[model samples]
Target chain A: MAHLASFSFTSSPSNSASSLSPLLQSHQQPHLSSPLQDTLINIDNSATMTNSYKYSVLLPTYNERENLPVIVWLLTKTFQENNINYEIIVIDDNSPDGTLVVAEQLQKIYGEDRILLRPRAGKLGLGTAYVHGIQHATGDFIFIMDADMSHHPKFMPEMIRLQQAKNLDVVTGTRYAGNGGVYGWDLRRKVISRGANFLASVLLRPGVSDLTGSFRLYRKEVLSRLIESCISKGYVFQMEMMVRARQFNFTIGEVPITFVDRVFGDSKMGAMEIVSYAQGLWKLFVAV
Target chain B: MTRATEAATAIGILGTIYLALLFQWLPITLPPTIQEFILPVLPWWVLVTFGAYSLGNIGYHVMTFRDCPEAYDELQVQISQAQNDLRSKGIGL
Candidate 1:
């Protein structure tokens, strides 16, 4: 009963159910109940013991020299404070702005074990960057986020907590759900984003909000399988990943996150990107 | 089933029902007033209502979308703190 009291709110209902069963059994066999409750408490302890699980953060970069160090710093700070085991795998696509140079400096500061640099030649796309990053990831779980400061590291612990509580295969950060919002977006940006989200929700019914949000956590095996199944580019890549996860019956959970847009760099939302997004959405609608 | 196929199947079922009613092919009949006045425009009514709902839903979300001024401020402080810490650690940023 005391062990059940310590369970987080997200998992409390289930914990309470298990805790109550022993109490109900106590009414039948008073002597046998103590050992039954002890085993239940031990199960809870073993769940927490699974914190030995390590996270591999795949931060794919292009021209984020100014943002890389700051994002890395925040990630390291968040993980360290939470006593989480994590490694930041920086996959740079040969940004002309010398992002790799800064990543190298960060590795020196954080050590090789913390920061793994996997530099690719030329401006290859994001999907390939993640694939390249995952090939070398050693952790039990994987985190994918933008190098831009828009996807903050602060909400990561909530995502991890939710994943652990629900035993979710994928935990996505949502900017449109409870306590979630965007910082730098104006009315136009808000309108466009909201409209796009509404359309996708109606059409796909993917059961996950914030389809375009890139900040997400996945079991390493689930992510590799998702990557193999996904078939989209640009903004729809993340959306398609959720759609495919549902198609494959992968459990998903959401944590609301504050999106700050880009603090140090220009955010990309051009007509071409929007056109590609529409095309990709339609492709998923028809093909998937 | 893919969403497209699901939607198409639903529409096909509904459309067939409507057509059966419209052509008087069904054993049972819709009321004369409904068959004449309402049935033909039901699809339009649904379309318009759905369009309005979509617009309203998006509008409500846009109006209510949170602006995290505090988060922005906190991020600024963290960024500068990170910069200072990195600088102190001898990593030129």
Candidate 2:
């Protein structure tokens, strides 16, 4: 159970809770000014932008002390190797495992500008954690994935490459497509996941294959738009995001990804989350 | 799925029954045994159900046609970053 000083991002607030929180952040974290200005654009074939893009990786962690360091290291290594301009925004919900302390230590090693730690008071909803994290992001694109190692940072470069190649609004990873498959789940768990996804496909017909998949990269504005339109606050949020994105006529593409189960602690998903997902599916069928 | 269709289905089924009774579409000219056996029961239930289903489908389309779609609310944004900051430092609201 470790935590640290609450500092805002370059454009972050001194105290975010103030009812008068600014609508737009006008400042950049002073530390980031130089690097951001001289950012080198990777994937030269990308013709969408005049300048290099800044990536904000939003990592939401709870009791992931053991796996956090490795994930962050991998992410930084991946971005650095590819010469990609990136920032890691960790939104940690006070874990009893001192995950925050490990995050701060990584920040010191990697430098504060590259590793930003934004810690919350308690265990907020997963949806809200992402909400909290995205606000502090100052990047052209946003990446959301698990810190528990279920998702590998190695896939990020390829995801970005594909996104730039297609200029897609969203590029989600699918375990049910291409060469992707679940790595460590038993038969019953596999059946449940497959069944849930199958039901979603039949009901929502969201064009895309993996509706429940969480690993994804989104253009900043598109991600913000979908998040605002989305109503789900739990596991269903992922599915609704894909469904609503289609409803809004946004282009979505998929990349096959091997979804390995978490390597540490425990999985946050459970019976309650599954039940909520079924209810959410029904609501989506009726509404969308 | 709208209220209009629910009401229309009920109305259509009842309406068909009333129209059937008034028009007496069931042929009374048939054999006495046939008339007595099939007259009041079989055609009534099946046609009423079919009538309800058909009108309900039409009503669903009509309601959809007349309904205006609500615009997505664009103003809703993420919460301020201070939610994480203030609490982590132990100065929570």
Candidate 3:
């Protein structure tokens, strides 16, 4: 909202309402009738296009060589079609499957400015990966999501618009809210997810619909601070980030997203993770 | 002032009042019939109600959870498109 004008694609109509997808239009506010409304209003206010906000996507990869290229392509296509300024930071923890090799190939295709490869020596932690990615991030806003293709990049434009409209610190994609849903999850998986979400909601009451969702857009500074303060790892890390975000009184928004469970890789939700999730929830409950 | 302490404080205060009322330690005593029947079973009722609510909530969510077969289908299409595009870009997938 701070004079960061949305991109104006000349090829598309000035009042291109069709740019808003059905999923995005469902949550559309009056001012958001078209994605170009902001540009039209703020065109005269800003002289230079260089100052428009940039979004940096942090995609952490581990044994995702197959999915990496496709996800990056999706992200690139989404941003290009939307005309949104962005960069994708691939934080590969020395993937044994040569995810870094694919990332380098993507860098060559997308150019070094758009795709960044910040590889680590070994498998570290999720929280630290974001921290590392953030250090190299050149964008005003940061997006953290899976490289495993569960979270589609199509929702990112809406997420960005929501953030801009509301001037929110965090905009998380929720599969539990609105028309958001998960694909490929069976009854047992659904039950466990719903049950775990219910328990977390009852106990922590974080005021966010999806506490464990990794698909989120954060103001760069806000993300840096949240990462600095958060102390958990794995699924709980995502949960704690939201809980802590609320504790800091940061404004948050939600965009319904379709999570098509890992199309190429195995999705993990074992008993060990569940137990550790409970322990992490308890820790945040008492400590936060 | 964390969530845990806040919950504990509320429960402790409510529990103290419930105990006092149940034990007839309060200045005003409850009717014997009401005290003997309702008070003792009140906690059980709350527990059962809470458990039922939780189950219902979880069940409702599970049932209503949307299945996006279209998204899966779209992704399948996009994956092929990406591979083709990447291939055209001279990067082997």
Error of 2 at A4 (Å): 59
Cα lDDT tens digits, model 3, B9-52, are: 99999999999999989788678887999999999999999999
TM-score of each: 0.89, 0.64, 0.88
Model 2 bad stretches (over 4 Å): A1-51, B1-93
Q: State each model's C-alpha RMSD to the native.
A: 6.7, 17.7, 6.1
iRMSD (Å), candidate 1: 0.8
For candidate 1, the share of real interface contacts preserved is 0.91
Prediction 2 TM-score vs. true: 0.64
Query: For residues A187-268, what per-residue lDDT tens digits would candidate 3 score against the true structure?
Result: 9999999999999999999999899999999999999999999988889999999999999999998988999998887888
Residue-level lDDT for B75 in candidate 3: 97
In terms of docking quality, how is candidate 2 classified?
Answer: incorrect
Which lDDT tens digits does candidate 2 get at residues A51-139? 38999999998887767776776787678766789999999999998889878877877789999999999998777887788889999
| lDDT measured at residue A206 in model 2 versus the true structure, 0 to 100 | 87
On lDDT, the leading prediction is: 3
Candidate 3 ranges beyond 4 A from true positions? A1-51
lDDT (tens digit, per residue) of candidate 1 on B1-93: 899999999999999988898888978867899989998898899999999999889998998899989899999999999999999998778
What is candidate 1's DockQ? Answer: 0.83
TM-score, model 1 to reference: 0.89
